[model samples]
Target: MQIRKKIYWSLCVLLLAACRQSPPPSRPNPVLQLREMGQLATTEYELSKVVRARDEATWYKIGERRMLVSCRARIKAGIDLSQIRDIDIQAQGDKISIKLPAPQILTFSIPPENIRVVYSDVGLFRTPFSQAETNAIMQQAEKQIRRQADSLNMLQKAQEGAAVFVRNFFEQAGYKEVTITYRYQENAS
Candidate 1:
Protein backbone atom coordinates (compact mmCIF):
# COMPACT_ATOMS: atom_id res chain seq x y z
CA MET A 1 0.00 0.00 0.00
CA GLN A 2 2.86 2.38 0.88
CA ILE A 3 4.59 1.68 -2.43
CA ARG A 4 1.37 2.31 -4.37
CA LYS A 5 0.83 5.71 -2.59
CA LYS A 6 4.37 6.82 -3.38
CA ILE A 7 3.93 5.93 -7.07
CA TYR A 8 0.62 7.81 -7.26
CA TRP A 9 2.12 10.98 -5.70
CA SER A 10 5.10 10.85 -8.05
CA LEU A 11 2.81 10.50 -11.09
CA CYS A 12 0.76 13.52 -9.98
CA VAL A 13 3.90 15.62 -9.59
CA LEU A 14 5.11 14.64 -13.06
CA LEU A 15 1.73 15.46 -14.57
CA LEU A 16 1.68 18.90 -12.98
CA ALA A 17 5.17 19.65 -14.22
CA ALA A 18 4.22 18.62 -17.75
CA CYS A 19 1.14 20.88 -17.70
CA ARG A 20 3.10 23.99 -16.74
CA GLN A 21 3.51 26.60 -19.43
CA SER A 22 7.02 27.57 -20.56
CA PRO A 23 8.25 31.16 -20.78
CA PRO A 24 8.24 32.86 -24.14
CA PRO A 25 11.51 32.85 -26.07
CA SER A 26 13.53 36.08 -25.88
CA ARG A 27 14.55 37.93 -29.04
CA PRO A 28 18.04 39.12 -29.96
CA ASN A 29 17.28 42.86 -29.58
CA PRO A 30 16.26 44.17 -26.18
CA VAL A 31 14.43 47.12 -27.70
CA LEU A 32 12.24 44.81 -29.77
CA GLN A 33 11.47 42.88 -26.66
CA LEU A 34 10.01 46.07 -25.13
CA ARG A 35 6.87 45.59 -27.31
CA GLU A 36 5.30 48.79 -28.63
CA MET A 37 8.10 51.02 -27.34
CA GLY A 38 8.29 52.60 -30.74
CA GLN A 39 4.62 53.44 -30.61
CA LEU A 40 4.93 54.78 -27.12
CA ALA A 41 7.78 56.98 -28.32
CA THR A 42 5.86 58.64 -31.13
CA THR A 43 5.01 62.32 -31.19
CA GLU A 44 1.54 63.19 -32.42
CA TYR A 45 0.95 66.59 -33.94
CA GLU A 46 -2.68 67.61 -34.13
CA LEU A 47 -4.07 70.04 -36.68
CA SER A 48 -7.61 71.28 -36.91
CA LYS A 49 -8.84 73.21 -39.89
CA VAL A 50 -12.10 74.27 -41.41
CA VAL A 51 -12.15 73.16 -45.05
CA ARG A 52 -14.39 74.33 -47.86
CA ALA A 53 -14.69 71.55 -50.40
CA ARG A 54 -16.53 72.06 -53.67
CA ASP A 55 -17.29 69.71 -56.52
CA GLU A 56 -18.68 70.82 -59.86
CA ALA A 57 -20.01 68.72 -62.70
CA THR A 58 -20.54 71.42 -65.25
CA TRP A 59 -20.02 70.72 -68.96
CA TYR A 60 -21.35 72.70 -71.93
CA LYS A 61 -24.07 74.09 -69.62
CA ILE A 62 -25.80 70.68 -69.85
CA GLY A 63 -27.39 70.05 -66.49
CA GLU A 64 -24.71 71.81 -64.45
CA ARG A 65 -24.38 70.62 -60.86
CA ARG A 66 -22.27 71.88 -58.00
CA MET A 67 -22.03 70.73 -54.38
CA LEU A 68 -20.32 72.29 -51.40
CA VAL A 69 -19.78 71.28 -47.77
CA SER A 70 -17.81 73.08 -45.09
CA CYS A 71 -16.41 70.93 -42.35
CA ARG A 72 -13.80 71.00 -39.58
CA ALA A 73 -11.34 68.10 -39.56
CA ARG A 74 -8.78 67.15 -36.91
CA ILE A 75 -5.73 65.43 -38.30
CA LYS A 76 -2.99 63.60 -36.40
CA ALA A 77 0.52 62.92 -37.64
CA GLY A 78 3.06 60.66 -35.94
CA ILE A 79 5.42 57.71 -36.31
CA ASP A 80 4.46 54.10 -35.85
CA LEU A 81 7.05 51.99 -34.05
CA SER A 82 5.56 48.66 -35.08
CA GLN A 83 7.64 49.13 -38.24
CA ILE A 84 10.94 49.28 -36.30
CA ARG A 85 13.98 47.32 -37.47
CA ASP A 86 16.94 46.01 -35.51
CA ILE A 87 19.40 47.88 -37.68
CA ASP A 88 17.77 51.17 -36.70
CA ILE A 89 19.13 50.87 -33.17
CA GLN A 90 22.71 51.01 -31.94
CA ALA A 91 24.37 51.11 -28.54
CA GLN A 92 27.90 51.56 -27.15
CA GLY A 93 29.46 52.10 -23.75
CA ASP A 94 27.72 55.05 -22.10
CA LYS A 95 26.21 56.09 -25.46
CA ILE A 96 23.19 54.92 -27.45
CA SER A 97 21.41 56.01 -30.61
CA ILE A 98 18.21 55.08 -32.40
CA LYS A 99 17.01 55.94 -35.89
CA LEU A 100 13.28 56.45 -35.86
CA PRO A 101 11.14 56.12 -38.94
CA ALA A 102 9.61 59.06 -40.72
CA PRO A 103 6.39 60.59 -39.57
CA GLN A 104 3.10 60.21 -41.41
CA ILE A 105 -0.59 60.65 -40.92
CA LEU A 106 -1.62 58.41 -38.10
CA THR A 107 -5.31 59.28 -37.79
CA PHE A 108 -7.69 61.20 -40.03
CA SER A 109 -11.11 61.30 -38.49
CA ILE A 110 -14.27 63.40 -38.85
CA PRO A 111 -16.67 62.33 -36.19
CA PRO A 112 -20.01 61.65 -37.83
CA GLU A 113 -21.84 62.27 -34.58
CA ASN A 114 -20.11 65.60 -34.18
CA ILE A 115 -19.87 66.67 -37.83
CA ARG A 116 -21.14 70.23 -37.80
CA VAL A 117 -22.40 71.11 -41.26
CA VAL A 118 -21.71 74.84 -40.96
CA TYR A 119 -22.82 75.48 -44.52
CA SER A 120 -23.90 73.61 -47.63
CA ASP A 121 -25.02 74.66 -51.08
CA VAL A 122 -26.39 72.42 -53.78
CA GLY A 123 -27.22 73.22 -57.39
CA LEU A 124 -30.74 73.19 -58.75
CA PHE A 125 -32.39 69.76 -58.95
CA ARG A 126 -29.57 68.36 -56.77
CA THR A 127 -30.10 66.51 -53.50
CA PRO A 128 -28.72 67.75 -50.18
CA PHE A 129 -25.40 66.53 -48.79
CA SER A 130 -25.66 62.98 -47.50
CA GLN A 131 -23.44 61.07 -45.07
CA ALA A 132 -21.52 59.63 -48.00
CA GLU A 133 -20.92 63.07 -49.41
CA THR A 134 -19.65 64.27 -46.07
CA ASN A 135 -17.26 61.33 -45.95
CA ALA A 136 -15.91 62.15 -49.40
CA ILE A 137 -15.34 65.74 -48.41
CA MET A 138 -13.53 64.57 -45.31
CA GLN A 139 -11.16 62.61 -47.53
CA GLN A 140 -10.30 65.81 -49.35
CA ALA A 141 -9.82 67.54 -46.05
CA GLU A 142 -7.28 64.85 -45.14
CA LYS A 143 -5.34 65.71 -48.27
CA GLN A 144 -5.42 69.35 -47.36
CA ILE A 145 -3.96 68.48 -44.00
CA ARG A 146 -1.18 66.54 -45.66
CA ARG A 147 -0.39 69.52 -47.87
CA GLN A 148 0.05 71.63 -44.74
CA ALA A 149 2.14 69.13 -42.79
CA ASP A 150 5.49 70.55 -43.82
CA SER A 151 4.45 74.06 -42.94
CA LEU A 152 3.34 72.92 -39.51
CA ASN A 153 6.81 71.43 -38.83
CA MET A 154 5.41 68.05 -37.95
CA LEU A 155 8.58 66.24 -38.98
CA GLN A 156 10.72 68.24 -36.59
CA LYS A 157 8.27 67.72 -33.75
CA ALA A 158 8.24 63.98 -34.36
CA GLN A 159 12.00 63.86 -34.33
CA GLU A 160 12.17 65.75 -31.07
CA GLY A 161 9.68 63.41 -29.45
CA ALA A 162 11.57 60.33 -30.63
CA ALA A 163 14.83 61.69 -29.30
CA VAL A 164 13.34 62.48 -25.92
CA PHE A 165 11.80 59.04 -25.61
CA VAL A 166 14.97 57.21 -26.55
CA ARG A 167 17.09 59.42 -24.40
CA ASN A 168 14.98 58.68 -21.38
CA PHE A 169 15.02 54.96 -22.13
CA PHE A 170 18.76 54.84 -22.41
CA GLU A 171 19.25 56.92 -19.30
CA GLN A 172 17.13 54.43 -17.42
CA ALA A 173 19.37 51.69 -18.82
CA GLY A 174 22.33 53.31 -17.01
CA TYR A 175 23.69 55.34 -19.91
CA LYS A 176 25.37 58.71 -19.20
CA GLU A 177 24.48 60.26 -22.54
CA VAL A 178 22.27 59.35 -25.50
CA THR A 179 21.80 60.64 -28.99
CA ILE A 180 18.69 59.93 -31.05
CA THR A 181 18.28 60.38 -34.77
CA TYR A 182 15.75 59.66 -37.52
CA ARG A 183 16.05 58.01 -40.94
CA TYR A 184 13.26 58.51 -43.39
CA GLN A 185 12.67 55.47 -45.54
CA GLU A 186 12.70 55.85 -49.30
CA ASN A 187 9.28 56.75 -50.63
CA ALA A 188 7.97 56.92 -47.08
CA SER A 189 4.47 58.08 -47.69
Candidate 2:
Protein backbone atom coordinates (compact mmCIF):
# COMPACT_ATOMS: atom_id res chain seq x y z
CA MET A 1 0.00 0.00 0.00
CA GLN A 2 2.76 2.44 0.92
CA ILE A 3 4.59 1.75 -2.38
CA ARG A 4 1.34 2.11 -4.32
CA LYS A 5 0.57 5.45 -2.66
CA LYS A 6 4.06 6.81 -3.52
CA ILE A 7 3.72 5.68 -7.13
CA TYR A 8 0.27 7.32 -7.45
CA TRP A 9 1.57 10.64 -6.09
CA SER A 10 4.53 10.56 -8.50
CA LEU A 11 2.24 9.91 -11.43
CA CYS A 12 -0.04 12.81 -10.41
CA VAL A 13 2.96 15.15 -10.15
CA LEU A 14 4.25 14.10 -13.56
CA LEU A 15 0.83 14.59 -15.14
CA LEU A 16 0.49 18.06 -13.69
CA ALA A 17 3.94 19.07 -14.93
CA ALA A 18 3.18 17.77 -18.43
CA CYS A 19 -0.19 19.52 -18.55
CA ARG A 20 1.28 22.98 -17.72
CA GLN A 21 0.97 25.38 -20.64
CA SER A 22 3.99 26.94 -22.31
CA PRO A 23 4.38 30.54 -23.39
CA PRO A 24 3.23 31.58 -26.88
CA PRO A 25 5.73 31.83 -29.72
CA SER A 26 7.17 35.23 -30.54
CA ARG A 27 6.04 37.16 -33.65
CA PRO A 28 8.35 37.86 -36.56
CA ASN A 29 9.40 41.35 -37.58
CA PRO A 30 7.11 43.10 -40.05
CA VAL A 31 8.09 43.08 -43.71
CA LEU A 32 8.76 46.39 -45.48
CA GLN A 33 7.73 47.37 -49.02
CA LEU A 34 10.73 48.33 -51.13
CA ARG A 35 10.97 49.84 -54.62
CA GLU A 36 14.09 50.09 -56.73
CA MET A 37 14.40 51.89 -60.06
CA GLY A 38 16.98 51.76 -62.80
CA GLN A 39 20.68 52.31 -62.36
CA LEU A 40 22.75 55.41 -63.28
CA ALA A 41 26.38 54.87 -64.21
CA THR A 42 29.27 57.35 -64.05
CA THR A 43 33.06 57.36 -63.78
CA GLU A 44 35.23 58.86 -61.03
CA TYR A 45 38.97 59.61 -60.88
CA GLU A 46 41.36 60.18 -57.99
CA LEU A 47 45.08 61.01 -58.19
CA SER A 48 47.80 60.50 -55.56
CA LYS A 49 51.46 61.54 -55.78
CA VAL A 50 54.40 60.10 -53.86
CA VAL A 51 58.02 61.25 -53.87
CA ARG A 52 61.01 58.93 -53.25
CA ALA A 53 64.77 59.51 -53.01
CA ARG A 54 67.55 57.18 -54.12
CA ASP A 55 71.03 56.71 -52.60
CA GLU A 56 72.25 59.76 -50.60
CA ALA A 57 75.40 60.17 -52.72
CA THR A 58 73.55 59.85 -56.00
CA TRP A 59 71.08 62.57 -55.04
CA TYR A 60 68.54 60.96 -57.42
CA LYS A 61 64.86 61.54 -56.69
CA ILE A 62 61.74 60.17 -58.32
CA GLY A 63 58.05 61.10 -58.10
CA GLU A 64 55.34 58.50 -58.43
CA ARG A 65 51.75 59.36 -59.27
CA ARG A 66 48.74 57.08 -59.13
CA MET A 67 45.31 57.57 -60.68
CA LEU A 68 42.45 55.77 -59.00
CA VAL A 69 39.45 55.42 -61.29
CA SER A 70 35.95 54.48 -60.24
CA CYS A 71 32.40 54.51 -61.47
CA ARG A 72 29.24 55.66 -59.66
CA ALA A 73 25.98 53.94 -60.35
CA ARG A 74 22.56 54.89 -58.99
CA ILE A 75 19.34 52.91 -58.77
CA LYS A 76 16.22 54.98 -58.31
CA ALA A 77 13.24 53.83 -56.30
CA GLY A 78 10.04 55.23 -54.77
CA ILE A 79 8.98 54.97 -51.16
CA ASP A 80 6.05 56.04 -49.07
CA LEU A 81 7.37 59.18 -47.44
CA SER A 82 4.91 58.82 -44.61
CA GLN A 83 6.14 55.35 -43.69
CA ILE A 84 9.73 56.46 -43.55
CA ARG A 85 10.67 56.54 -39.91
CA ASP A 86 14.42 57.13 -40.05
CA ILE A 87 17.32 57.98 -42.35
CA ASP A 88 20.93 56.97 -41.84
CA ILE A 89 24.09 56.72 -43.94
CA GLN A 90 27.27 54.75 -43.39
CA ALA A 91 30.22 55.14 -45.75
CA GLN A 92 33.45 53.20 -45.90
CA GLY A 93 36.38 53.31 -48.30
CA ASP A 94 34.39 51.90 -51.21
CA LYS A 95 30.91 51.29 -49.83
CA ILE A 96 27.97 53.41 -48.78
CA SER A 97 24.99 52.67 -46.58
CA ILE A 98 21.79 54.68 -46.62
CA LYS A 99 18.61 54.59 -44.56
CA LEU A 100 15.40 56.59 -44.46
CA PRO A 101 15.01 59.43 -42.02
CA ALA A 102 12.66 59.32 -39.09
CA PRO A 103 9.08 60.24 -39.87
CA GLN A 104 8.21 63.73 -38.80
CA ILE A 105 4.83 65.40 -38.42
CA LEU A 106 4.92 68.98 -39.58
CA THR A 107 2.23 71.68 -39.55
CA PHE A 108 2.27 75.13 -41.14
CA SER A 109 -0.09 78.02 -41.96
CA ILE A 110 -1.06 79.50 -45.35
CA PRO A 111 -1.49 83.10 -46.49
CA PRO A 112 -4.67 84.82 -47.74
CA GLU A 113 -3.32 85.91 -51.14
CA ASN A 114 -2.65 82.33 -52.17
CA ILE A 115 -6.20 81.10 -51.57
CA ARG A 116 -8.78 81.15 -54.43
CA VAL A 117 -12.47 81.06 -53.56
CA VAL A 118 -15.11 80.57 -56.28
CA TYR A 119 -18.75 81.31 -55.60
CA SER A 120 -21.75 80.27 -57.75
CA ASP A 121 -23.00 83.90 -57.61
CA VAL A 122 -20.09 86.30 -58.07
CA GLY A 123 -21.45 89.77 -58.99
CA LEU A 124 -23.91 90.70 -56.23
CA PHE A 125 -24.94 87.43 -54.62
CA ARG A 126 -21.39 86.88 -53.41
CA THR A 127 -21.68 87.16 -49.66
CA PRO A 128 -20.01 90.34 -48.59
CA PHE A 129 -18.42 88.56 -45.73
CA SER A 130 -16.11 89.89 -43.09
CA GLN A 131 -12.35 90.04 -43.75
CA ALA A 132 -11.69 87.17 -41.34
CA GLU A 133 -13.57 84.57 -43.42
CA THR A 134 -11.88 85.62 -46.63
CA ASN A 135 -8.50 85.59 -44.96
CA ALA A 136 -9.09 82.12 -43.48
CA ILE A 137 -10.08 80.60 -46.82
CA MET A 138 -7.18 82.17 -48.61
CA GLN A 139 -4.79 81.02 -45.92
CA GLN A 140 -6.03 77.46 -46.16
CA ALA A 141 -5.52 77.31 -49.90
CA GLU A 142 -2.10 78.88 -49.64
CA LYS A 143 -1.10 76.33 -47.05
CA GLN A 144 -2.09 73.42 -49.27
CA ILE A 145 -0.14 74.82 -52.22
CA ARG A 146 2.88 75.52 -50.09
CA ARG A 147 2.82 72.01 -48.71
CA GLN A 148 2.83 70.55 -52.22
CA ALA A 149 5.73 72.78 -53.24
CA ASP A 150 7.67 71.81 -50.18
CA SER A 151 7.18 68.12 -50.90
CA LEU A 152 8.49 68.50 -54.43
CA ASN A 153 11.45 70.51 -53.23
CA MET A 154 12.33 67.87 -50.72
CA LEU A 155 12.17 65.11 -53.35
CA GLN A 156 14.41 67.05 -55.72
CA LYS A 157 16.89 67.71 -52.99
CA ALA A 158 17.01 64.06 -52.04
CA GLN A 159 17.65 62.97 -55.63
CA GLU A 160 20.42 65.52 -56.10
CA GLY A 161 22.01 64.59 -52.82
CA ALA A 162 21.91 60.88 -53.64
CA ALA A 163 23.70 61.46 -56.92
CA VAL A 164 26.41 63.49 -55.28
CA PHE A 165 26.85 60.91 -52.59
CA VAL A 166 27.29 58.10 -55.10
CA ARG A 167 29.88 60.08 -57.03
CA ASN A 168 31.89 60.86 -53.95
CA PHE A 169 31.75 57.31 -52.71
CA PHE A 170 33.19 55.96 -55.95
CA GLU A 171 35.93 58.58 -56.08
CA GLN A 172 37.03 57.87 -52.54
CA ALA A 173 36.94 54.10 -52.93
CA GLY A 174 39.43 54.17 -55.81
CA TYR A 175 37.09 52.00 -57.80
CA LYS A 176 36.77 52.25 -61.55
CA GLU A 177 33.15 51.15 -61.66
CA VAL A 178 31.03 51.64 -58.59
CA THR A 179 27.40 50.72 -58.75
CA ILE A 180 24.88 52.18 -56.32
CA THR A 181 21.46 50.71 -55.90
CA TYR A 182 18.85 52.96 -54.32
CA ARG A 183 16.20 51.05 -52.46
CA TYR A 184 13.11 52.45 -50.82
CA GLN A 185 11.21 50.58 -48.15
CA GLU A 186 8.05 51.34 -46.22
CA ASN A 187 7.99 50.82 -42.48
CA ALA A 188 5.10 49.13 -40.78
CA SER A 189 3.10 51.14 -38.29
Candidate 3:
Protein backbone atom coordinates (compact mmCIF):
# COMPACT_ATOMS: atom_id res chain seq x y z
CA MET A 1 0.00 0.00 0.00
CA GLN A 2 2.87 2.47 0.76
CA ILE A 3 4.53 1.71 -2.59
CA ARG A 4 1.19 2.23 -4.38
CA LYS A 5 0.73 5.58 -2.61
CA LYS A 6 4.28 6.66 -3.61
CA ILE A 7 3.57 5.72 -7.25
CA TYR A 8 0.29 7.72 -7.17
CA TRP A 9 2.17 10.78 -5.77
CA SER A 10 4.84 10.45 -8.48
CA LEU A 11 2.13 10.28 -11.19
CA CYS A 12 0.45 13.39 -9.78
CA VAL A 13 3.76 15.29 -9.86
CA LEU A 14 4.35 14.23 -13.50
CA LEU A 15 0.84 15.36 -14.50
CA LEU A 16 1.33 18.75 -12.82
CA ALA A 17 4.65 19.26 -14.60
CA ALA A 18 3.14 18.28 -17.94
CA CYS A 19 0.21 20.66 -17.53
CA ARG A 20 2.43 23.68 -16.81
CA GLN A 21 2.58 26.24 -19.63
CA SER A 22 5.92 26.90 -21.28
CA PRO A 23 7.31 30.46 -21.50
CA PRO A 24 6.27 32.36 -24.63
CA PRO A 25 8.76 32.36 -27.44
CA SER A 26 10.72 35.58 -28.03
CA ARG A 27 10.87 37.38 -31.41
CA PRO A 28 12.93 40.16 -33.00
CA ASN A 29 11.78 43.75 -32.42
CA PRO A 30 9.69 45.42 -35.12
CA VAL A 31 11.13 48.33 -37.13
CA LEU A 32 9.03 51.51 -37.47
CA GLN A 33 9.04 53.65 -40.62
CA LEU A 34 8.44 57.42 -40.49
CA ARG A 35 7.78 59.52 -43.60
CA GLU A 36 7.59 63.31 -43.77
CA MET A 37 4.69 64.77 -45.80
CA GLY A 38 6.51 67.97 -46.72
CA GLN A 39 8.95 70.54 -45.49
CA LEU A 40 7.34 73.15 -43.17
CA ALA A 41 8.13 76.64 -44.37
CA THR A 42 8.20 79.30 -41.66
CA THR A 43 7.10 82.81 -42.71
CA GLU A 44 7.26 85.89 -40.48
CA TYR A 45 5.57 89.27 -40.97
CA GLU A 46 5.89 92.52 -39.00
CA LEU A 47 2.24 93.25 -38.15
CA SER A 48 2.67 96.89 -37.10
CA LYS A 49 4.76 99.43 -35.18
CA VAL A 50 3.06 101.46 -32.46
CA VAL A 51 3.90 104.32 -30.10
CA ARG A 52 2.92 104.10 -26.42
CA ALA A 53 0.87 106.89 -24.75
CA ARG A 54 2.49 108.02 -21.50
CA ASP A 55 -0.34 110.38 -20.38
CA GLU A 56 -3.94 109.35 -19.94
CA ALA A 57 -5.26 112.51 -21.61
CA THR A 58 -3.68 111.82 -25.01
CA TRP A 59 -6.21 112.09 -27.85
CA TYR A 60 -4.76 109.18 -29.87
CA LYS A 61 -7.23 106.37 -30.34
CA ILE A 62 -6.52 103.48 -27.97
CA GLY A 63 -6.91 100.75 -30.63
CA GLU A 64 -6.97 102.22 -34.15
CA ARG A 65 -6.93 100.74 -37.62
CA ARG A 66 -3.48 99.22 -38.40
CA MET A 67 -1.70 98.71 -41.71
CA LEU A 68 -0.99 95.04 -42.45
CA VAL A 69 1.96 94.06 -44.65
CA SER A 70 3.48 90.70 -45.55
CA CYS A 71 6.72 89.92 -47.35
CA ARG A 72 8.84 86.80 -47.81
CA ALA A 73 11.71 86.80 -45.30
CA ARG A 74 14.20 84.38 -43.74
CA ILE A 75 12.91 82.30 -40.81
CA LYS A 76 15.62 83.64 -38.46
CA ALA A 77 14.02 87.07 -38.07
CA GLY A 78 12.14 87.82 -34.82
CA ILE A 79 8.67 88.29 -36.28
CA ASP A 80 5.22 86.83 -35.68
CA LEU A 81 5.71 83.50 -37.47
CA SER A 82 3.22 80.73 -36.69
CA GLN A 83 2.02 78.01 -39.05
CA ILE A 84 2.32 74.28 -39.65
CA ARG A 85 1.56 73.30 -43.23
CA ASP A 86 1.71 69.55 -43.47
CA ILE A 87 2.33 66.40 -41.41
CA ASP A 88 1.77 62.72 -42.14
CA ILE A 89 2.39 59.32 -40.60
CA GLN A 90 2.69 56.02 -42.41
CA ALA A 91 3.10 52.45 -41.14
CA GLN A 92 2.60 48.96 -42.52
CA GLY A 93 0.89 49.97 -45.78
CA ASP A 94 -1.44 52.35 -43.91
CA LYS A 95 -1.08 56.15 -44.06
CA ILE A 96 -2.49 58.85 -41.81
CA SER A 97 -2.34 62.60 -42.41
CA ILE A 98 -2.35 65.16 -39.61
CA LYS A 99 -3.67 68.66 -40.19
CA LEU A 100 -2.60 71.37 -37.77
CA PRO A 101 -4.98 74.26 -37.04
CA ALA A 102 -4.22 77.91 -37.66
CA PRO A 103 -2.67 79.85 -34.82
CA GLN A 104 -4.65 82.67 -33.15
CA ILE A 105 -3.38 85.83 -31.53
CA LEU A 106 -4.35 85.36 -27.87
CA THR A 107 -3.34 88.78 -26.57
CA PHE A 108 -1.57 91.91 -27.69
CA SER A 109 -0.42 94.81 -25.49
CA ILE A 110 1.11 97.26 -28.05
CA PRO A 111 -1.24 99.61 -29.91
CA PRO A 112 -1.90 98.73 -33.55
CA GLU A 113 -0.83 102.03 -35.17
CA ASN A 114 1.86 103.40 -32.83
CA ILE A 115 5.53 102.78 -33.77
CA ARG A 116 7.35 101.05 -30.91
CA VAL A 117 10.65 99.43 -31.89
CA VAL A 118 13.11 97.40 -29.82
CA TYR A 119 16.44 96.01 -31.06
CA SER A 120 19.44 94.28 -29.56
CA ASP A 121 22.98 93.76 -30.88
CA VAL A 122 24.24 90.16 -31.20
CA GLY A 123 28.05 90.00 -31.24
CA LEU A 124 30.33 87.04 -31.82
CA PHE A 125 33.41 86.51 -29.66
CA ARG A 126 36.65 87.32 -31.45
CA THR A 127 38.92 85.40 -29.09
CA PRO A 128 39.96 81.98 -30.36
CA PHE A 129 39.16 78.92 -28.25
CA SER A 130 40.98 75.58 -28.17
CA GLN A 131 39.72 72.95 -30.62
CA ALA A 132 39.79 70.26 -27.89
CA GLU A 133 37.53 72.33 -25.61
CA THR A 134 35.13 73.07 -28.49
CA ASN A 135 35.00 69.42 -29.43
CA ALA A 136 34.33 68.42 -25.82
CA ILE A 137 31.51 70.91 -25.52
CA MET A 138 30.04 69.72 -28.84
CA GLN A 139 30.29 66.10 -27.71
CA GLN A 140 28.32 66.91 -24.55
CA ALA A 141 25.70 68.75 -26.56
CA GLU A 142 25.48 65.83 -29.00
CA LYS A 143 24.98 63.38 -26.14
CA GLN A 144 22.15 65.50 -24.76
CA ILE A 145 20.58 65.76 -28.25
CA ARG A 146 20.78 61.98 -28.69
CA ARG A 147 19.14 61.45 -25.33
CA GLN A 148 16.26 63.76 -26.38
CA ALA A 149 15.89 61.86 -29.65
CA ASP A 150 15.76 58.53 -27.76
CA SER A 151 13.11 59.95 -25.43
CA LEU A 152 11.00 60.99 -28.41
CA ASN A 153 11.32 57.51 -29.91
CA MET A 154 10.20 55.97 -26.62
CA LEU A 155 7.23 58.35 -26.51
CA GLN A 156 6.18 57.35 -29.99
CA LYS A 157 6.35 53.70 -29.00
CA ALA A 158 4.24 54.42 -25.94
CA GLN A 159 1.64 56.28 -28.00
CA GLU A 160 1.33 53.29 -30.33
CA GLY A 161 1.81 50.70 -27.64
CA ALA A 162 -1.59 49.01 -27.99
CA ALA A 163 -1.38 48.85 -31.77
CA VAL A 164 2.11 47.43 -31.57
CA PHE A 165 1.04 44.79 -29.08
CA VAL A 166 -1.89 43.78 -31.28
CA ARG A 167 0.28 43.59 -34.34
CA ASN A 168 2.83 41.49 -32.52
CA PHE A 169 0.18 39.15 -31.18
CA PHE A 170 -1.38 38.71 -34.60
CA GLU A 171 1.99 38.05 -36.14
CA GLN A 172 2.68 35.45 -33.50
CA ALA A 173 -0.67 33.92 -34.35
CA GLY A 174 0.46 33.61 -38.00
CA TYR A 175 -1.40 36.60 -39.43
CA LYS A 176 0.58 38.26 -42.26
CA GLU A 177 -1.20 41.60 -42.76
CA VAL A 178 -2.10 44.12 -40.04
CA THR A 179 -2.56 47.89 -40.33
CA ILE A 180 -3.45 50.86 -38.13
CA THR A 181 -4.56 54.41 -38.91
CA TYR A 182 -4.31 57.39 -36.58
CA ARG A 183 -6.23 60.63 -37.08
CA TYR A 184 -5.89 64.00 -35.39
CA GLN A 185 -8.82 65.99 -33.98
CA GLU A 186 -9.27 69.65 -34.88
CA ASN A 187 -9.77 72.06 -32.03
CA ALA A 188 -13.11 73.92 -31.69
CA SER A 189 -12.97 77.59 -30.91
In order of appearance, the predictions have TM-scores of 0.54, 0.27, 0.20
Global lDDT for candidate 1? 0.66
Please give, for residues 72-99, the per-residue lDDT of candidate 1 as tens digits.
4555656777777898778788877677
Q: List the global CA lDDT of all models.
A: 0.66, 0.41, 0.36
Q: Rank the candidates by lDDT, best first.
A: 1, 2, 3
For model 1, the stretches where C-alpha displacement exceeds 4 angstroms are 1-41, 53-72, 80-90, 121-126, 183-189
Error of 1 at 165 (Å): 1.1
Top TM-score model:
1
**Alpha carbon lDDT at 9, candidate 2:** 100
User: Which candidate gets the maximum lDDT versus the true structure?
Assistant: 1
Cα displacement (angstroms), candidate 1, residue 42, comes to 2.7
lDDT of 3 by residue, 128-170 (tens): 3244533444344434444443333332333244345445655
Q: In model 2, how large is the Cα lDDT of residue 181? A: 35
Give the clashing residue pairs of candidate 1, or none. none
